[model samples]
Target chain A: MTLNLEPLWLTLKLASLTTFVLLVIGTPIAWWLSQTRSRMKQVVATLVALPLVLPPTVLGFYLLLLLGPAGPIGKLTEALGLGTLPFTFPGLVVGSVIYSLPFLVQPAHNAFEAIGSRPLEVAATLRASPLDRFFSVALPLALPGLLSGGILAFAHTVGEFGVILMIGGNIPGETKVLSIAIYDHVESLEWTQAHWLAGGMVLFAFLVVLSMNLLGQRMRQIGQD
Target chain B: MIELDVAFRLDRGNFTLDVAFTAPGLGITGLFGRSGCGKTSILRCVAGLERAAGHCRLDGETWQDDAKGIFLKTHRRPIGYVFQEASLFAHLSVRDNLKYGMRRVPASEHQIAFDEVVDLLGIRQHLERAPSGLSGGERQRVSIARALLTSPRLLLMDEPLSALDHASKQDILPYLERLHDTLRIPVLYVSHAPDEVARLADRIVLMRDGQVQAIGSATEILSRLDLPLAQDTEASALIEGRVQSHDDNYDLTRVAIPGGTLTVGRLDQATESRIRLRIHARDVSIAIRKPETSSILNVLPARIVEMQEIDRSHLLVKLCTAGEPHPPLLARITRYSRDRLKLEPGQEVFAQVKAVALMD
Candidate 1:
C-alpha cells in the first residue's frame, strides 16, 4: 500500500508552528525568571516546568476543558466570533506549545543566568542604556541557549502523542499527527506502514539529538576562542 | 570640585559605609584603603552603580542627591568605570567592544575620538581579536579604551589592576601614567595597593573601616606619621622637586628638592622639569653628623619632628628639612640607632637616603 504521507506533513507543520509561537512568548518569561529577585519567581518557574513532570494527558485534559464550548475561554472566544478551539488545528498548536514550554525556557534561563551582572554593569558605565545593553550584550551572549531551546521544543513537539489525542482528537488533516497515525496503523494490523513510520521517527529523533550535540560543541568551541 | 557625601549599609554583611570628601576636579584622586574598607563601594556610589543614599556632585553637576530626590542612573551619568576585572563583552570583538559605548553617545558629546583612545591604550594591534583570546593586560587596556571612547566627564577605576599578574600590572602602568599625563578628565582611582596610589595620584583620600581618615595632597598624606601608611613596612615619603643638572660623567641627575639637592639615577627629563621622588622609610638612615665621604648620594640636614614606636625594635621617625619648607620625610630606623643618636623632636641630624625612586 502507498503511504498517505499526510500525517508526516501535518506533524512537521504543527511542530514548526508550536516552536515559533513558544519562542516568541517564552523568551521574556525566561528572562524574567532569570533576573527577578521577587518571591514569586519560584512559583512562576514551577508552573512553567509542570509539563516536564506531570503526565501529558493531565495537561491535555485541562486544556481541552479550557478550550471546549462550555469552558470560560471557549465561551469568550465564541462571543468574539472565533468559536471554540477543541478538535481544531489551532487547538493542536496550543497543546503542543504548552507541552514543550519547559524545553524552550530552561536553556534560555540558564544562559541568561550564566552571564552574571558584570557585563551589564560594564555596559551601563559605557553609557549604554538598559534597552541598548539588553539587545547588544545580553541577547548575543544568550543566543546559544535560545537556539538549543528552540530545537528541543521543536523535537519534543514532534514526539508528543497523548496531548494531541486528548485536545486535538484524530481529525484527518487537522490532528492526525505522525504518532497518532502510527497507533492507528498498528491497531488495524497494518504492520508494514507502521514499521515505515516508526523507523522514520527513530531516525528523526537520532538526527535531532546528534545535531544538538554537534551544535553545543561548536558553540563551546567558539566561546573558548 | 568632586563632592561625595554617601552613607549606606550592605545586607550580605554587617558593613556600613559612611564617607564624605571633596577633591579637585582636574587630577587623579586616589581612594587609598585596605581591602574590605568599602573603597569599591564608594566608587560604585559615584558611578551611580550602587543605590546609596547621599549627595554626589561632580564639578557643579549633581549626580545623586537623596534629599532632593534626584538620582541619575549609571547610564545617564557621564562617567566611565573600569572594573577590577576587564569585563569586556565576550561575544564582541575588541573593536566592537571599544565602539559599543561610542556609538551610544551623541555625536556632539564625542570629545574623545575612537582612534585616539585606541592609540592611547596601545590596543590598535588587537582590535580584531576576541576578548577570550586576549591576555589579561590586553583585555584591561581594551576595556579602558572602550570607556574613554564614551567621552566621560569623570572616570572611576575600581582596583583596575588588582586582577593582573605582576608582569601584566607592570605592562599596564605606563599606559595609566600616560592617561594621567594627557587626559583632562577627573579620575577617581580606588586601590588597596599603596604603590599604585603613590605612583598615580596627585591627591589621596585615605580610608579606614568605611570612614574617610584624611584627604590631602599625595605628598602630605603619604608622609603623615599619624596614619597607618607610615607604620607599615613599605612606608615611604613623596617629595616634589625640579631637575637641576645631569652629571653625564656619572650618569646621574641632581634634583633640587625643598632644602637640598639629591643626586639620583639618570632621568630622561629636561632641566627644570618637575619630578616626583619616592624615598622609602626603610632606605633612610640617620647620622648625628654629615659624613665627608660616602656611597649614599642623598644626605640633607633635617630636624626630627616626631617619633612613633612602630614596634619594640623599630621606630618611625618624622623629619623636616632644617632650612626650607619641604614635605616631611619618614625614616624607619632601629630603636638602637635612635638611642645611640639621642634623637628627639628638635634635634638636628642628617638623613642619608640609600635609594631614591624617580616617579613622574
Candidate 2:
C-alpha cells in the first residue's frame, strides 16, 4: 500500500501539543478537585467530564461556534491580531485538549486521592507551608498519576476523529490528521493510501497504548504501597 | 503552662467528635480513651488540623478563639503532631523526610537541630532508605523524629502505637520515654491502655463519649474502683521508686519509694537508676497482725485509708503506709475478707503488698 507521511506527522504534532497544553492547565484543576470540599467541586467535576460523555461531534459543533471568526473566542483572538484559528493546527490542538479533559483529569484526580491528605498534614506539621507541602510532598507522590494522565490524554487525542473533523476540518499539513487522511483517500477511490494510513495509525496507537499501560501499571504499583 | 480550652462539633456519617479539655503545663499529660472515642480529633483540634468551636490557648499564646477572631491555621500554629500512621513521604528517603521539617522551620524559630533528632530517634542507620522499606516500628520512630525536628512548643501524638504489634510498641516505647524525660517540651499523648498511661502519664485526662471524664494524676485515677480500666487483674499502683541497693547474693533489690523502703525481687542492675514499679492491687494481702513466717518480703503497717465495693464479689481497700504523705494505693479483696477483719477506712494494719514488678 502506498503511504502518505504528511498527515501522520500532523497527527503526532497535534496530539503532542494538545497533551502538553492540557497538562499545564489540568494539573492545578485536578489538584483542586482532590483537595476541595466546596459545592463547586461537583459542578466543576461534571463540567470537566462532559467531553467524555457528550458526543464528540456535538462538542465540536459548539467549539466551532466559540472558535469561528465571529464567535467570542475567535473575536477576542482576532482583536489580539492573531489570525483565524478554525481549520488550523492550533484549532485542532485546542479541540483535542477539550475532548480529552477526562483522560487527563480522572487519572490526575485518582493519583492525588491515592496520595491522601495525611502526608500533606504531616508535611504541615513539619513546618511546611501549603505551597511548600504541595511541591515537596504532593507533587512527587502524584507524579505517577500525572504521567499516566498525560499518556492517556495523548493516546486518546491521537485517535480523535469526529471532533477534529468538525472543528479542525481537512487542511493538509494543518488539520489533515491520519484519520482524516484515511477518510479522504477512501473517498477519492484511493484504496492504497487508505490502507497505508490506517496501518500507520494502528501501529502508532498500539505502541503508544502499550507503553502507556505499562507506565500506568508501574505508577500504580509505586504509589502508596 | 499550656492551657487548651477548645470545643468542636463535627457530624460525620455515623460518628460524632466534640471534645474540650485542659492539661498540666509540664511532663507527659495523657489523653486516654477507648477506640472511636474522639481521641485523635482532640489531638487534631490542638494541632489546628481541625477547627473546633471553642477557644485554644497554650502558654498564653492563642491558637484559636471563635469569639475573639483569632484562628491560626495548622501550619501557623506551633505544634508537633505524630499520627497513627507514619504517613512519611514515600518518595523521599528517611534523611529527606527528617529534613522536610527542618528546612521549612526557620533557623531563628526552631531550636532543635537535625543531628539531635537523628540521634534521639536512632534513625541514623536508616537515613538512606525510603520509608516503604522500613518496619512499622522504624517508620513510627521516623514519624516521631520528623515531628520533633520541627521544634514546636507542644507535641501531640494520636495513638501512635495503635498500628504496631506488641514487639513494635515495645521498640518505640523507650524512645518515647526518653523524649518525655529529657525534652523540656510537654507532650499530649492520646491512648486507651491503662498500662501505657500508668507508665508514661504524669497527668491523665480520661475520655468517654467525647468528654473529659476525669483529669488527675495517673496514680489517683488508676486506683479508682469504678472506671472501666480499674477493674482489671492488672490493676496496679504506679509508684516512682529510686533504686537504693541490690544484693546479688540475696537475690533482692531495695527501692526507696515516696512512703517507705520496698524490697522486691532482685533485678540484674546497679543502684541510682529510677524505675517505675507496678504493685498489682490483687497482689496485696492485709493481715490484722504482723505475720512471722512467709515468702513475701514486703509487709508495712498501713491504715485503711478508704474502703469501697468494686463489684458484687470484691471490696477495694485503700492503704496509707507509715511514711510521710505519699498517696494511698488500692488493694482488691473479697467482701468476706473485709468483714472478717472488721476493716474500716482508718483501721491500722500491716499492708502486705504481695510483690512489686519493676517497669521502666
Candidate 3:
C-alpha cells in the first residue's frame, strides 16, 4: 500500500505553526503568572491549565462553537473579509494552540519562577530598563524552560486527534493530522498503513521526549558551570 | 559636594522604618547599624529601589518626594549599588557584565574608564569568563567593577563584604580602598562590622531600631564613650595620620599624628600617605609623668577631656593630644588607678600607647 504523505506534512505543519504561536502568546502570560501576586493570577493560571485535564472533544466543541458563523470570532473574521475559521487550516492551527496551551506555558512559568527576582533587580541597578531587563536577563535565564515548553507543545500538536476532528474535520490537506489519518486506516483494516504511521508516531514521540530530557540535562550542566 | 537628606517611613509587618538624616556626599559615609535596623532599607530608598513615604534628595537632585508625587524609578536614578551578594548576571561574561552598565549611559557621561575599573578591581584575567566560574572574591570584584563603570552620582554599597569569607574579604578590601581613595563620587557604605566601618568611613551614621542614633565623623563616633560601641571590650579610637618615616632595619614605621609621632610596625605604604591608626583604649595606659627609659614606643602629652565610670571596676578616660586639634583618644584604666592618681578632667597627663594597630 502506498503511504499518503499529506497527513504527515499536515501534521508537521500544524505542529510547527501551533508551537510558534503558543510560544509567542504563552511567554508573557507565563511570566505574568509566575511574577504576579494578585488574586487574579490563580484564576488565569487555572484557565490556562484547564486544557491539560479537560477532554479534547469538550474543548474542541467549545472552540468549534466559537469559530462558527454565529460566533463572535467568526463574525469578526467575516467582517474583516477573511471569512469563518471552521474546517480551515487556520482553524486547525488555533485549535491546536489552545489544545496545547498548558504544555507550553507550565514549563516556561516554572522556569521564570525558578529565576527569582534578584537578577532582574540587579539588572535594574545596572541601569537596565524593564524591557531591557526582561530580554537581557529574564529571557536568557529562562531559555531552558522555553525550550522544553516549545518542544512539548510541538509534540502534543503533532499527536492531537480529537480537537482537530471536532473543529476542522478530516479534510485531507487542511486538517487530516497523523492521528486522525491513523484512525481512518485502522477502521479500513489497512494494518500495513496503520503500522507504518502508528509506529512512526511512537518512534518520533519517543525520540522527541528523549532529546528533551537530554537537552534539559545539558542545559543544567551549562547552568551549573 | 553631594548632600543627602533622607526621611522615610515604611511600615513592614512588625518593624516600622522611621528614619531621617542629612549627610554631605563625600568620602564614604557609613550607615552603621545592626541587622534589620533599616540600614539597607535606607540605602535602597536612596537608590529608588524601595518606595517609602518620604523624600530623598541626592546632590540637591530630588529622587523621591511623596508629597510632591515625584519618585524616580531605580533605573532612572544615577546610582551604582553593590549588594551583599555579587548578583552578577549568570548568563553574561565578566566583560559583558561590566559593559552592561556602560551601554546604558551615554558615552559622554562615562566618568570611569572600562580599563581603569578592570585594573582597579584586578579582574582583567577573568574578563572572558562567566560569573559562575569565578570565585566569591572575583565575582564581587567584577560586580564592583560593573557598578563603577556606571559612573553613578552616588555609590551605595550594602555590606559588600558581608557575604565573603575572611580570605575573600582580605582580597577585596584593597580594591575597595582604591575606589574609596580615587573615586570622587560619594559612597554610602552599610555595614555592621565596626572595624570595616572604622577603616573605610570618613563619617559614620549610627542606627538603632530604625532611628538615627548618632551621626558624626568616624573618629568622633568610634571614640564616644557614651555610644554603645565604645562600651565594648575592643573599644578603640580612630586616629588619622600620615606615614612619617620608615625604619626598614627594625621593621618600624613612624606615623605622625596631630601633635606627636607614633612608632608602629613597618607598613608597606609610601611616605606621607594618609593612614588610620586604631588605638584600643585598653592598650593605652595613663601616666602621671612622662617616663624616662621605657620600652613603650609611643607616649604623648594628653589632657584629660572627660572621665566616666564604665562600670564599678573600670574608668573610661577621654584624652586629646596636648596642643593639636586631633581626634580624642580613649584610655581604660581601673577605678583604683583613677583614685590613686587623682586624675581630673582638667589635668594634663601622658598617654603611653603600648600598641597602635594600623587600619588601612
Please tell me which predicted candidate would have the highest DockQ against the true structure: 1
Per-model clash counts, in order, read 0, 2, 0
Task: Please give me the total number of clashing residue pairs in predicted model 1.
Answer: 0
* Candidate 3 ranges with C-alpha deviation above 4 Å: A222-225, B269-273, B304-316, B332-348
**Ranking of candidates on TM-score, top first:** 1, 3, 2
Greater-lDDT candidate between 1 and 2: 1
| DockQ class, candidate 1 | high
User: TM-scores of the models, in the given order?
Assistant: 0.97, 0.94, 0.95
Best of the candidates, lDDT: 3
B1-360 per-residue lDDT for model 1 (tens digits) = 454334444443678787888777787999999999889998988888887767888777888888899999999999889999999998889999999988889999999888888899998999998899899999999989898989998888999999999999999999999899888888999998888988899999999888889999988888888887777788889888999999999999999999899998899999999988899999999998898899887899998989999899999999898655657888999999888888899888899999998776
Candidate with more favorable, higher DockQ: 1 or 3:
1
Two-chain DockQ for each candidate model? 0.84, 0.80, 0.75
- In model 1, the runs with Cα more than 4 Å from the true position are A219-225, B1-13
- DockQ value for model 3: 0.75
lDDT of 2 by residue, B238-262 (tens): 7777899987788889998876788
State each model's TM-score restricted to chain B.
0.96, 0.90, 0.93
